[model samples]
Target: MSGNIRSSLRGQRGMSYWSLIFYISGFALIILFASKLAPGYVDAMHVENGLKDLAEKGNIRDMNRGEIVRDLQTYFMLNNVRGEPTKSVQVIRGAEGMLVSIDYELRQPLIHNIDVVMKFNKQLNTAKPELCCEPLVDLEQYRKRD
Candidate 1:
């Protein structure tokens, strides 16, 4: 009987009940936070792709500023993005080509007063259509800044 007990105890190799619960709860929190933040990233991608298409494919050479703004607003509508695009988007037409500035921030509530802010800052030229901006590259480390 004592030998049987010793064998059973040796065979039991796993986490304790409390330890398992702690790890499971921690993982659950991470997943919950990720689910909340993933949509913001998706919206940013839509905006970035829209900018790329506008700079590369759209005929902005002959279009006026109003036309450009209207087109961009329509794109936002199609992508289900909130707020006015004009608030964050700026268009400059020079002798060379059009210069577009896309700077926007997405805010999501995490705790009571604490919120997560995702900023997307990018500049694109119609003459040079390349996506160079990396979203949240500067905020890789989470720390309070003064």
Candidate 2:
């Protein structure tokens, strides 16, 4: 009877240990997924808002550069929480017909506290650029500029 009680107690302890492990593993997986997907989700939102803002404020020829910049900043704030702008915007105006360029950055989430930069450029409708760029590349370059 004494041995049986000891075995039963040991079994309960073992089960408790396994339960703790299971909970920890589940938490880790959740964190991993959140870290991976959060950045992409935030970026997609920024791009969508940027495009909509651009379209609504149509006729780029008539749009005010400062207004556009303000719109972009507003969109970034509305969509992005993890990464946000930190630097004064660098607006490269046409010099000798040089195309205008805008650069911004976003600080994103990662397992090791990594950051991603987001960038957007309005240049001569050269090559008929895509209506929207992907979230990973230039999107990161134009994220919440810092």
Candidate 3:
């Protein structure tokens, strides 16, 4: 009776070889998907942050549509953003401020004949400055005085 009990315990010690292989394969697939998709998400975040930064500069309300597009292109270049330039940035003037919008897409190859595509849209409202006030002293002048 004791030998029979020990034999049963040994058989239940751990997962079977086939079960371990299945679990490892599933985890590998998840990691592969994440590695392929993470860069696109990161780039989208960078684009969003760049739009916010431009809005915070408090000059978008004064720039024309063309100027806004040029500014966005420059920002993308500065930040090393990767994607095709299909749609340009849109700048709409409003009663209280300007609305800047960026719409774009990214495509990456996953496996044979398979690709991952992502689309993103980011917008921001930049208010016009109420007053144009110069600093009390120029930085160059202040440095010379010091």
Best by TM-score: 1
Give the better candidate number (1 or 2) by lDDT: 1
lDDT tens per residue, model 1, 47-96: 77777667766576777778777787788788887663347776677677
Q: What overall lDDT, based on C-alpha atoms, would model 2 receive against the true structure?
A: 0.49
**TM accuracy, model 1:** 0.75
lDDT of 2 by residue, 45-110 (tens): 555556445554445545556765675677667766323331333333333221123334444555
Better of 2 and 3 by TM-score: 3
Model 3 misplacement above 4 A = 1-4, 85-87, 94-96, 127-146
lDDT of 3 by residue, 15-38 (tens): 989999999999998998899989
Count of backbone collisions within predicted model 2: 10
Candidate with maximal lDDT: 1
